[model samples]
Target: MLKFTLKRLGYMLVVLFIVVTITFFLVHSIPGDPITAMVQDLPEETRTVYLARYGFDQPLGVQYVRFIKACLCGNLGESLRYPGRKVIDIVRNYAPVSGVIGGLSLAIGFTIGILCGILAALNRNKWPDKLIMVIAILGTTIPTFVTAAVLQYLLTVTWPIFPTTGWGQAKHIVLPVLCMCVGPVATYARYMRSSVLDTVNQDYILTAEAKGVSQFRIVTRHIFRNSFLPCITMICSSIAGIFSGSFIIESIFAIPGLGKYFISAINDRDYSVVLGLNIIFTGIYILAMLLCDILMALTDPRIRYSNDR
Candidate 1:
């Protein structure tokens, strides 16, 4: 187990380095200059000074080395557009908002998805099952941006029940969370339904049924637990997606999350922020995968024994 974990950590470091290197070069490869974007109409000499100030005048190799060094020392440098602000500080300010919304959305999604799946599976081929399946299909088919737009129109613009956009109030989170969760709920529901249906047909399930185990106990203990195993990996992977913030949802609602900042950084040619955020997101996903592996090992003895071997 220790060896496996150490190996995973090594792989994660390699992946993070690759992500950082790629993002650095890709951002630099884009047409035009960040300095020009920062100071639109600066005199040539002044632009030279600006470039020198940010180390942009240095050779690409030198800049890359310095950037890597700074990153190793936990400095992602200042935002090109925001001047005095550090990338880490900006991330700290925005990540919590995204985290809160993401956490809530995931909780809601998992709960609703599991319940709906169980209901549908138990009532297979009936109206209840059909209705849930239809809703799941619609949820999966609709785009998040469209969902956000429609919800905003119906709940905010027409009804005036919540604020149209912007952060601060608790009400601001509702629409975006709902919009984001729909897709996840649909996805999880389908997976859970299939898993449960398959589990129900297993010999052990038939044996349990013959033993006259109560329906609820059979479903929860015998079926749902086994069915839930497949979802652990999916749920862990989704954690990064949730915390990253849905770009469209954040933009539509003017939520000042990392996703909003990331988009702005790209458009404004703020390479520091863009590169830093990308690395952070990459680290998040890699870490989530590690957690998923650990979780799977804990839940399944087969995985644990295989690793032990």
Candidate 2:
């Protein structure tokens, strides 16, 4: 396991380098110059100052080398959109807001989804099963943004159960968290239901039943344990996706998250913020997949990972 983990860590560094390099070059290659665009209406002297401040005055190769060095030293550079702010500072400050909402959403979604799936599977082909499936279908089919809008309208506009916007308070988190939950719950429920059903039909389950093992023990010991192994991947994948995608929900609700800033940075051609955020997300994505692979190997005895590879 140690060797396997070390190998994955090495791969993670390689992937991070590739992601950072690609994002840096792509951002620089964008048509408009951030300094020129941001300061187009300001004084001519201001433009030159801004250019020098962000190293736009230097050649692209030099800038890339500096950016890489800064990243290695844990400095993400200064933001081009919000002057006088470091990119790392922005991430440090804003990440927690998104983190709170995303974490809560995942916990709720996973619990509700997995339980519902188990329930649906236990009642296979019955009314409960059919009803859960329908809910899962709707949740899977509906886009998150649309769900956010509809939820905002119903919860805020019509019912007035929660406020439409703002962060820093628990009430503000409810709507965004709820909106994010819709898709995850649907996905987990459907997948879990299938896993449970498949586990029930396995030879071991039949043997346990034939041996006069109680239904409850059989399910709790064997079925659920095996069925839930798949969810490790699902939950980790959601972690990668939710952090990146939370920007849209944050934008709609005015939540002031990294995603909210990310959108604005893109529009303003804020190279530092964009590149920093992209690298952060890409790292998270790669790390999550690595965790998924490790968790699967550890939890499921049937699978073995060879360190020699």
Using TM-score as the measure, the top candidate is 1
For all candidates in order, the CA lDDT equals 0.87, 0.86
Query: Model 1: how large is the Cα RMSD against the reference?
Result: 2.2
> Stretches of candidate 1 above 4 Å error?
1-6, 37-42, 157-160
Q: lDDT for model 1, on a 0 to 1 scale?
A: 0.87
Worst 10 residues of 1 by lDDT: 240-249
Clashes of 1: 0
The sequence of per-residue lDDT tens digits that candidate 1 reaches over residues 158-230 is 9999888988988888888998889888988888888889989999998998999999899988998788889
Misplaced by over 4 Å in model 2 are 37-49, 304-309
Candidate 2: which pairs clash?
none
lDDT (C-alpha) at residue 202 in model 1: 91
Model 1: pairs clashing at backbone N, Cα or C within 3 Å: none
**TM-score result, candidate 2:** 0.89
* lDDT by residue for model 2 (36-99), tens: 7666677878887878977888999999999999999998877766778887788788888877
